[model samples]
Target chain A: MEGGVYLNLPKVAVLTMEGTNNEEEAFQSWRGAGANAEIIHIKKLENKIRKLEEFDAIFFPGGFSAGDYVRAGAIMASRLRATVMRDIENFVDAGKLIMGSCNGFQVLIELGLIPNIGGDYEREAALATNLSNRFEARTVYLKITNNTCPFLRKFRINQIIRLPIAHFEGRFIPANEDLLEEISNNNMIGLKYVDPYGKEVGYPWNPNGSVLNIAGVCSKSGNVLGLMPHPERVFNKYTQSDWPRGNEEDYGQLFFKGAVDYLNEKF
Target chain B: MKINIIVTLKDNVEDAEGQSVLKALHLLGYDEVSNVRTGKVYYIEMKGNDLSKGYEFCDKLLANPVINKCKVERDD
Candidate 1:
């Protein structure tokens, strides 16, 4: 039946665990974009009830997964690395489009999946506590630095979009300048914190004092994207903090939509 | 044996927590203190005297070599 094509949408797993409260919105965003998405507990993957290869893509939603006590995204990444590191590594290597938001971004960095300079899971960076020394929750303007990344294809290069970021450890600093140079040279820097006017700014404008004002990044392959922003919360304009200010377009949904669209077109 | 591990950001990395603490100390009239840095301490209890295992944990899980360094002290 030709109508069966609609029933064969790509499956996206919005992985979750106790304290990870953002899976619902992430799942909705994926499903809203025509993917069959689900809120899957990390245990399901760990216990092998569900398999990573079953899904076309996997998303790590924002939340204090594992209470974020030791470090943001530390425990969850450690657990996953211990159990399913090979599967996840292969998933990224296979270009299955993995994405993470906010705390999930921290997990990616902890897992050494982003800016994976040498194709090895060597953690070359750390998302330390914000320079302001507090959890910041605000809408920030991000300049899309690289459109070649599948996640940022909907956005034009240098396009500035508004997204809300909420986190304490949002500062993205790599281990050394060499690695930073490598990421920049590879165009792995996907999003940069900028003012609404699109000027690279500092403090309140930058929001997290990230090095070079980086807000999001992709791997060298650009299939995996990690950003410290709550794109899921703004699936619609009404969810945006500035909705009353004549906000109309939903920029956040475009990201997930782009990923889904890429998956559909590719596989 | 009990092993105590102290983990802290490398000296070059900016310690925002330490700066905030310094600010508080200045407000408290203790102006002589020149520097402050925040770090973590973890105590691991084990039965073997294999010192290399402690360093191994430090290299792998206990400390992020990218931005942190860890020191292990043995307490028998």
Candidate 2:
């Protein structure tokens, strides 16, 4: 239970494709937190399927892949479906951790990797263009939801974590009333927008019109996590815009730590 | 065959961009408008005999279930 005691630190593989650019940041975050991490290119994935079985966790990082053509993560998700999507499903089914951030989160939604907004297992939550219809780059406060998601187990409920979110399509929208209700009832609401004072407020603070200010969610088993924020960007103290006075010691780093801790416990 | 696809937010759903557009319209002296919502239109040309198949393509592939709803029309 000691901090950074990744005695069984899970081997993590970050999926990289033609345009994915955050794999290195993610690798560094995990590695700095004491987990073994590596970046695996999409072309090499076919030859590394067997090696994937040895890892305890896998991640998809953010980037403008394939020029975000045909919708943000559409092409990449389709490619994954063609290749190792089934393997990812198997890994999740086996109770291993799978994470997607930013564009990666979009891919998860597009591929039906994470549960959708409703419809039991296939509920599709909404991720769309920002209200401003332009790319937004800013640091936002997030209120972590009180959920049983393994990726967030170590964090306290309603914790106000400052993380930088840069994207054009981070708004989450649930398609219907039933879907919205299901997302609420199941505690699938993982992260929400909040004020710097730790209060759940509206607009600009939320940055996007995400329903209920949701910023992240996990699969029913809490093994699959998809988030719009970029924790990798904030792994280092110097990366934070308001480092010292904010007294914020890299909330993003804690995220990787939490994941590694979970893996160490399970493995 | 020519097909028209219309995409809109579900009813009662808030449209932030549309609201801003309405504000702009009001400022432009178009006071007759009471409400406004923004949507997308897609025109597609297909070389096929079956119209239903083309409609299916719009529903399954083009539009996403999360934020969009699409309607297909064929100009016969």
Candidate 3:
């Protein structure tokens, strides 16, 4: 369907930077979900060529930004914090939407967007190196833990979905035990790694050995979401690994669509 | 002055890289090696001799306080 067919379609900015790939698919996913999408370089925002305020939602695609120097997503997060932090804070305050996957998820954690327990954007969690000690590249099962998040409204609680995850540092580690409790109590965890049958069998099923089998998390407000899996890559059922095995679910498209629907109704 | 910052995962956190290195060392007949921890060192040159600046840099960028501990040292 043409975006022109929909009035006031949400404008999405797929934010990218050097070494940050996957913007192409992310843009396509947003457009497929009936949103106007554009791939914007970080430099554009830094140089004032384009402003975050112009977009209704922002998508941070996957890949190693700044070559993953210092840490995955650390460089990009620091640069954004140094330059457009105020704009981001304003965007969040305005109740807009934000989503990130894989390295993008790492950026959100580094920026302290998800699980911003202090409400000050102070870093409170880290996506540490995988306990497997190697880069895990495979499609895994995820159980939707919180359907209240805009990105997950199309899903149901305890619904199992399949998405591809590729990364070396995908483990979700909170700053402390109290923070972990807060994330759980607030229903900030959006997804959890699970088996094909929705069992929490550790290892290859969990992939990263993330705490509490967390595969994705959301901000306390449920507007911002970050996950280690690449939903954009699997927007089509044919792209899923088990599609040849008679899988017919296009699980990824719902993520973008849900957010777009929310943006249109709310913003 | 040159400031050096060493960033490593906190002691309580599981160090997968360190464990891998320890396993490799044990295989190479270095059984006496009890432990191995991994970290990154950044050497920065500054005109001003301010160790606090280095700490500030670490806090803002070089180190993520959630999983990392940064030690800043000044070399003149």
Candidate 4:
């Protein structure tokens, strides 16, 4: 406030509710990156106790929210649409950051927030059940496709990163062919599955049989991102599935750090 | 009022579960089964006879248009 630079710290909200078990790790990741982060329950927002506008950035962490019944991420998204749809729309239009990972990624698609190529907030894609016909839980390699998204700002384009993903519904498919083209032309794709050697692969390597090997995507504005992986599970080399080999660097921390840094500079 | 809703994957979308189910049926000597697909059905009893409102609810929350198509009918 003294030198025209805001002295107040940026606040990031890691939203959660019953059945959302990943909020703790996601909260720690944000706080570890020098942001004032909190785990806020959806009830707090719905009951008017907390407003979504209060936070500079918002994260929908991975979990089986609402028991993941009906469909993964359906119940929670429906509840939000029934009440705070306008608030979310405005938040996105204002260029605030929003990220959803794993089951949270499913929620983002259900909420019509990610890959909103037309800016209509229409549900144009789905995270369908995997072709494997079972839950997939393991570490996989992902190549960053576009770094324009705030969440991927830390990674170079086409850089391969290893992260763990645990989900039954992780296959990303667009509603139609035209929408797929729009996503590509708009540069909304954020990550694509690849082998450790950086070759485009399928099946066990791709893990989910997603279209174009897409692992994650963002909104046209690049503020909203959704991915079916758990970066929080690998904040350090010790936590990674197979680590201490490469650079032993904590690759997962870069994502949360990028978000915090972006918010700090923009706000 | 009673309503029955059926939700199915779009025609172009691959039904991996349905295909697997069909494969199992074939192994069980059910060669008569030419094809198989999976879907969800919801039977609800509402307070009014507003069919349009029922459809709206289905469109908004009951099914995702991305990979699903829904059919709503009166449960007569």
Candidate No. with top lDDT: 3
Measured against the true structure, the TM-scores of the candidates, in listed sequence, are 0.96, 0.83, 0.97, 0.95
> Model 4: how large is the Cα RMSD against the reference?
2.7
DockQ of each: 0.67, 0.33, 0.93, 0.67
Q: Write the per-residue lDDT of candidate 3 for residues A1-267, one digit (tens) a residue.
A: 554665568899999999998999999999999898999999999999999999999999999999999999999999999999999999999999999999999999999898899999999999999999999999898999999999999998999999999999999999999999999999999999999899888999999889999999999999999999999998998988879886457899999999999998997
TM-score of chain A of each: 0.97, 0.91, 0.97, 0.95
Candidate 1: TM-score of chain A is: 0.97
Interface RMSD of each: 1.2, 2.7, 0.5, 1.0
Better of 1 and 4 by lDDT: 1
Query: Candidate 4 residues A195-232, lDDT tens each?
Result: 98888888999898999999999888898989998988
lDDT of 1 at A161: 89
Per-residue lDDT over B12-59 for candidate 2, one digit per residue giving the tens place of the 0 to 100 score: 556777888898999999999888888777777878767676556544
Displacement of the residue A189 alpha carbon in candidate 3, Å: 0.7
Residue-level error in angstroms, candidate 3, position A239: 1.0
Query: Model 2, stretches more than 4 Å misplaced?
Result: A1-9, A46-54, A117-123, B1-48, B73-76
The lDDT values for all models are: 0.89, 0.78, 0.93, 0.87
List candidate 3 segments past 4 Å from native: A1-7
Error of 2 at A74 (Å): 2.2
